[model samples]
Target: MSIRPTIETRKAVPTMEGAGVHLHRAFGFQDPSELDPFLLFDDFRNEVPEHYMRGFPWHPHRGIETITYVLNGTVEHGDSLGNTGTLGAGDVQWMTAGSGILHQEMPKGNAKGQMHGFQLWGNLPSAQKMTAPRYQDVQAKDIPEVIDDDGTVVRVIVGEFWGKTGPVDGIAADPQYLDISIPPGVKKTFRIDTYRRAFAYVFAGQGAFVDASAPSGVLLEKEVMGQEVNIRDMSGDRTLVRFGTGDEVTVQAGEEGVRFLLISGAPIEEPVAWHGPIVMNTQAELQQAMRDLRNGTFIKPAH
Candidate 1:
């Protein structure tokens, strides 16, 4: 029952991607090993249609998987493989860009001109990097939501939790993705696999992550259940919290309650050679991928 300590906390940086679409990047283009098997995460939430209408134009990706979860509005997507679909609110699309593929995602805001969603890039192991590309498109209704006795709600998007299993499966990283909401002033603890690298992205309201084992400098005293506990600062919107090795994570919601995404995956622990959307194990592989794109052969023939 060890509690995971908060190792680092930082706010997501505002960034523009995919033809001037505004978004916030929590982590990417840095030390890939820091959150092994997970390369990038972006919160593409926008209230202005002009900011996101351009969306992600046709792009090539390989050696990785892209998971797009939509909370509001809709996303229309098409791929070079001749597949087309529209993802509405609460829909999730998990695309495995094994070998290679070209795709385009165009977003359309909801009636109120609001669009919010997240995109997470997961790395594939070397053995599966050249596997056939596939897609797992799960609708919101298919995703299981569990409510605890204390009114804590958890939407299990991937992996098994609370006597339920997520719809998306056969993933390389074996990750667990959870969308959780805690009521105001409520405290909750979640169990995570100690062997996996885990992180939480706070996107709504505020909360303090309790870490009894945290160092002195970042520790703040707070009263929990009549006992004094050390916790980090109240994490608000777009905050990223990385946890140290442990099996449990405790968070106390603020007055407005808190909603966050808790994601964890088994570490790949392999050398990464990445450039733009393509991620490979070595520079030579990346170079070959670029050459393939130039030669109009990036998309392999389906078997």
Candidate 2:
């Protein structure tokens, strides 16, 4: 099994969105091809209620799917289709804005006034761009979790892993989203499909994604003889690690352990015409979508 090499590792950038809500963007509004079939990823976490309570007000999305995973707190959401629900801690809501949809998400903090969550936008292929809107709201209990002997825990959120499959399926990207945590001083390797594009976002503790074959100048931290070495190369909190071609990824947890989201998806490799929340294959199609919104025809009649 070839170990995927770390191509780049960078910290998530702070950004504000949706009526003054504060969040950090891992990747978005840049080169979409870097993570094809995936458009944006935002980490919305705050201890101050004022920073996130305003939430994402009513917004329209088309030609894409938005996956919201709540780590703490709750997100009350309502869509144009009359679908309404609340996503609490560990809950996941996958919304497909195939043709079009308008939705609002209001976040509420927990008892300590802390809110944390992630939202990922996945692109829909041209063929299914205008199919139909749908939702897959999976409760925390319905999702599968796998535990290893060495205290490695993995929550399968969107695809199969460790003999367990996620509750949310039928996604166009066929992506695998996993929340993984490793015990301190543990070394582990994960297998990913060779044809898929994969990345890891570290949100807790420090670790080194190691690959002996990693390209020149790629730094990595690893323990030697029970002594932490190359400490400067450790990746910690809110770091985004992008991997090169391979079928496996290896990581060594630091003294405090490490937790991260490991995500991978098949590439769409299609043209993307994007604006705000709407994504299309061509500029003309994007123009048509705007015209539809202007003419009150953005929401297609249910069949």
Candidate 3:
């Protein structure tokens, strides 16, 4: 109940990633303290196979967790530990970098070369930076989808929702990851943990997120009929909406309806030293991680 007044909204920046893949970067590499315990979010979406085929080559991650969610196409991934899998539409993979690891993800489009997905980077505390790398691959079929009487659907991926807990757990940030959709002209407000920082990313269609205490970007939608009046404050798809403190969030879907990912997590408030895929507390720890990687012993011994 002690949540502060609404904070200013931070819009997603248009950026490219993954070998010429077009995407929007929500935030990264600057003022980590603003979003303590959580580092970055990227919305990678494309309709041309040639744009995404290059994919993400083998890369290293050490002190962070990466969550990948596929919306339309298929993403085949492999890690240094020999784990391999494919994530189809709606599937999620939460990978903990822990000590260190090498991973690659290749994207293949749907029938029309339509591919859409997102990746979020969650930071790990210093104590858990080397606590054994692991993964929770949540398949699309296994994710719990709850339908409200009003035609709203929600898919819980990382935390609890309406008394149901997500399959992925034991995370340092105790995050709540939800994919939600509201039917045309429906207004819905769902409860979120007031203690955690929360944000939403609009992926499909358009909507207005509102609340009396909501930030300025909280828009008012007025259209002639069956048309989406692109609110001047928000971009089209791949727009990231960061919310202010509130137990409940209200959203009104436009004529085309709206689909978005709503996520929240408790702030660690701990020091963060980040470089590339690795994050640690002290510079010395980061140096050690790099040295270990160079020495070919970054992964901890199997117990």
Candidate 4:
């Protein structure tokens, strides 16, 4: 099996969004070609209430699906369809903005005054872009967690892994999303579909993704019986690792262990004409969407 090589590794950039909520953006709003069928990934984490209290106000989204996973706080959300709910720690909200929808998300920190979460935007193909809006609110208990012999733990949030299926389904991209934690000094490897594009976002501790063929970044080596060795880069918190074509990924945890999100999905490969939240195929179509938004016709009539 071919081992995926780390093509790009970068730290998430600090950004302000949703009425000045502090967050870090791993990748988005630049080029969508490399990460096809996946538009954006954001790491919204803060220990101060002022940093996240503002929250995301009402916003419109079309032709995409948004996945929000809460780690330590609560997110109170409401949509134009009159759907409302609270996403607590470890909860997940998968919203599909097929045709169009307006929604708001407000954050309330835990007792310790900490808020941690992630929001991922997945693209929709041209055919499914305007299907119908829907929501999948998955509680923490519904998601399955697997622990290996070495104490390696993984939580399947979407798609299937290790004979367990995620709570979120009927997604067009067919993505596999997992929350993985490896104990210190442990080594693990995961096999991904050869046809899918995959990436990992590190949020805790440090680890190295070893490429069987060659190392990607700085490595610390040790000598065993006068033999030279190489190691992979120990990527730390808020780091994003984009992998090249392959079917397998190997990682070795550092002294402090590591935790990250491993996500992969099939590429759409269709032309993407995007502006903010509304993604269409052509400039004219984007203009039409804008007109509809302004004219209060973005939401279609019920049958």
**How close is every model to the real structure, measured as TM-score?**
0.96, 0.96, 0.90, 0.95
The sequence of per-residue lDDT tens digits that candidate 1 reaches over residues 132-228 is 9999999999999999999999999999999989999999999999999999878889999999999999999988887544545756676644545
Select the stronger candidate by TM-score from 3 and 4. Answer: 4
Backbone collisions counted per model: 0, 0, 0, 0
- Residue 124 deviation, candidate 2, in Å? 0.3
**Residues 156-241, candidate 3, lDDT per residue (tens digit)?**
89899977778888999999999998888777787888888887788888776644344445556566145444354332366777
Model 1, TM vs. native: 0.96
Worst 10 residues of 2 by lDDT: 212-221
Which run of 10 residues does model 1 get worst, by summed lDDT? 224-233
Q: State the TM-score for model 4.
A: 0.95
Alpha carbon lDDT of residue 276, candidate 2?
97
Go through the candidates in order and give each one's C-alpha lDDT. Answer: 0.93, 0.92, 0.81, 0.90
Between candidates 1 and 3, which one is better according to TM-score? 1
Q: Poorest 10 consecutive residues of model 3 by lDDT?
A: 1-10
Global lDDT of model 3? 0.81
Alpha-carbon runs more than 4 Å astray in model 1: 213-232
lDDT of 4 by residue, 130-227 (tens): 88899999999999999999999999999889888999999989999999999988878998998899999999998888754454456678432243
